[model samples]
Target: MKYKTKSRHIFILMSLLLITSLVAACGGPATPAPQAEPAKMEEPAQTEESTQTEEPARVEESAQTEEATTEETTETASATDSTPDSGSVELPEVDPLAVTGDIISAGSSTVFPLSERMAERFQDEGYGGNITIDSIGSGAGFERFCVAGESDISNASRPIKDSEVESCQSIGREPVEFRVGTDALAIAVSQENDFVESVTLEELAMIFSTAETWADVNPDWPAEPIQRFIPGTDSGTFDYFVEEVFDKDEEPILSAGNLQLSEDDNVLVRGIQGSPYAIGFFGYAYYNENQDTLTVLSIEGVAPTGESAEDGSYPLARPLFIYSTAGIIAEKPQVGAFINFYLTYVNEEVIDVGYFPASEDTLSVAEASLLAALK
Candidate 1:
């Protein structure tokens, strides 16, 4: 019975084994193969981390670069905006007939004739406004224009003094200098005097100062008393003379005997023409106007000609200037118009008035000054 039972169990085991083999053949495997989903999931996680961190950092870097570029552009624009206008400034044209209002100018006696001529022409061209010009000395002129604030313009032979400029500022005015023409300071003697045709700078200084007689200056000259006629201390001409001849020391010339000082060049001219021993120095225009009675002495072998003055060869050649404030120009439109006309037509009348026209460069600068005042 035991052997029969063992044989039956072996048969059943053999049948079960055959069934399992058939199932394994039909399906591939009972347990599932390791899934690729986990590796794919890890890849997505890494990609998300890169987008959140590394990609944002790159984007942030790009944003920073853009910000730097914007700052650079702003700085470049600022730098450009701060630069001064160095290009040519356009001068406005004047229609004198259409303008109206009074204009007052006072200053140097040397600039008086030129300013007077311009004023006449402005009126002749149909300007209806009254233009008053006073022939006060430069110091007095500045006193009126800067300190008292009475004049619209100030005429000057020499540059404005710092103290005068400060005075202008005290009255809410900033004086602007406009170069109008050039003048040679004429050292003249009576036409009847044939002894001196020229003089050295040293001899010229002595004749105006220490020398008591013509013979004291030169042995060949006659022993006549030196009659010295000079511009007054208030005159710009006086200031220039003292600066050039006396090393800015006025004591020598001021204390000299036979010295006569006048604000009017006409007075000096008449005084100088009275005697052969008489000598005086004033603007070339005064000498030119009275050339028949006066003989202009050459200094250091250089005469006061337009050519010599323009070329800077003449030692006493000086620039003639007119000064006005921007406030005045704006307050009086007629003043602006008149200055425009003067600057535009100055050359036409300057030569005829016995003064040299300012150089083209200088005229342009004058035009620029007018332009600035108008603005």
Candidate 2:
């Protein structure tokens, strides 16, 4: 009975030792190792996934910023190059004469300075071969221009008369009219003549006509004889003075052959400037050129100037004209170009040359009319 009891005790001790060893081996090999390996692997995977997501988002944001910047830069560049800041566009660079082809322009000697300046500028810009201009009396110019196929342009101090238009139409041509600027027909005397200050329209008529002496027009004036220099019958200036001041009536003194007549306003200026008692009338440009030697007389107590002329305060103000043939513009590219350039530069250029620019509304109407006629 003692030996059997001892064998059972030994078997029990062996079973307990085996169970403890198995538990330690299973726990060591599986529990702690699985937990450590899963944490290490999962941490790296999660970090990589987060890194990939953030990189793509950052790249997209950077691309969007770059695209927006590029678009803004492009828009700014386009705006700077296209629009004119001053509301007026710089004229496109073009050879004015070359664009027009061969050009022929003739007109009022009074309108000569502006035309000559334009022609000179055109030539300087390489248009010398394309343009030729002449300064003839306004009536003579119209007479030639009205003849069908005669001339490309006619410059005039006055608008085309109904009779002149009929003359053009009779020859199978129509004249398109353009107003370039305003003029003040100034009555000038020698700078030495201090007796005269101002005169009314009625007084001008009397002074130009039957009044042979200054004292005849005004009893308080000097007794010296008043010498007169008048433009010839073919001058538009003469016609304007006749119509505006004389009521188109024939001057008895002019009919009596007492008035000195000349086609050249320069000659008239010379005649007046040479004689202290002499008086003559011409366009403001001529008066401006001879301002040193001549004294401009106020009409109805109003001086002739750009402001006064524009406001109708100057009685002698008149509209200057450019008459173009419709047929010429159709057949000649130069004629169209010349007209366009003239209209484009006239506002500033006309004023630069001692003439008044037309109002903006008038210029707009003229440009629209010319463009439509060209079309």
Candidate 3:
């Protein structure tokens, strides 16, 4: 009985020990490692300290940006100072004979005779350097001046087109125009033809395009087939004729039968001289050269002559031009000097070249333009 009571006491003691261990596991305080770290997050932030540390770097970046901006502004102003505007340019009167350097020019077959004469006079006056002039038409000349950037000067029978100006601007060249002379375009027929002396604009158009026979143009005339000769499409004269006479529609004239087109005005003169039925138009200089072989026609009772061209009496009269930029003049002093000489002497030689001298006001304006460009 003593041993059994001792055994019951030992079992009850074991049961109490196990119950105490379970209560401790279920309800005792945790170590709280995660919660302790969360409170530490509320302490002094290192980000604020890092931001303060980067303050100097931000200031430095701003300073660098401002410096770059200032540099760019300075460079822009310096560039502007280097290139002067044409309106503000001023050129001093200088001697052309003392100038040197080769001159390269292209454009305008009509202007060729005038330029050639000027070049000869320039050489006679003592310019030893070669002056090369090309008669490659105005459009081709602009291409050489603007697109190719090859020629120092471009001669044009007509003013530069908007497209040509755009081309020059694209290549960083701004063309300046100088009116050099006036041209009287002459319509000529073979010397053998004496029946027709004058024609109206309508009759001229009909003769060149729609009229197949002389009777087609006029009932009183004979039924001879009409022959037409004209400048090539590349010629500025062609553009002018199409614009003025055909209303810029070239199809009627270009599509006509018995039509001959040539870039050389001399060829056109020859073509007209070949047959009495043939007729053609070209610069007055060409007509003047072949006057014996060809007959100059009276258009609407107006004849082409220097006085008629200058006085604006001739219907086919047009202005002639030569172009050079201010930059070109400054860079090539010889070109500038040559232009000065040409302008001073053009009026004297223009008649010899079969063109008219520009009016006094026109010459003055040209001189001012040149002076302004060179200033």
Worst 10 residues of 3 by lDDT: 45-54
Stronger candidate by lDDT (1 vs 3): 1
**Which pairs clash inside model 2?**
100-334
By the lDDT metric, which is better: model 1 or model 2? 1
Model 1, 274-342: lDDT tens per residue? 899999999898988997899999999999898999999999999999999887766566676778788
Q: Residue 24, candidate 3: how far off, in angstroms?
A: 99
Model 1 TM-score on a 0 to 1 scale? 0.77
**What is every candidate's alpha-carbon RMSD to the true fold?**
36.9, 36.8, 28.9
lDDT of each: 0.81, 0.73, 0.78
Q: Candidates ranked by lDDT, best first?
A: 1, 3, 2
Question: Which stretches of candidate 1 lie above 4 Å from their native place?
Answer: 1-89
Task: Say which candidate scores most in lDDT.
Answer: 1
Alpha carbon lDDT of residue 264, candidate 2? 71
lDDT of 2 by residue, 6-58 (tens): 99999999999999999998867777566567545433212112223223244
Positional deviation of residue 300's Cα in model 1 after best superposition, in angstroms: 0.5
Whose TM-score is greatest here? 1
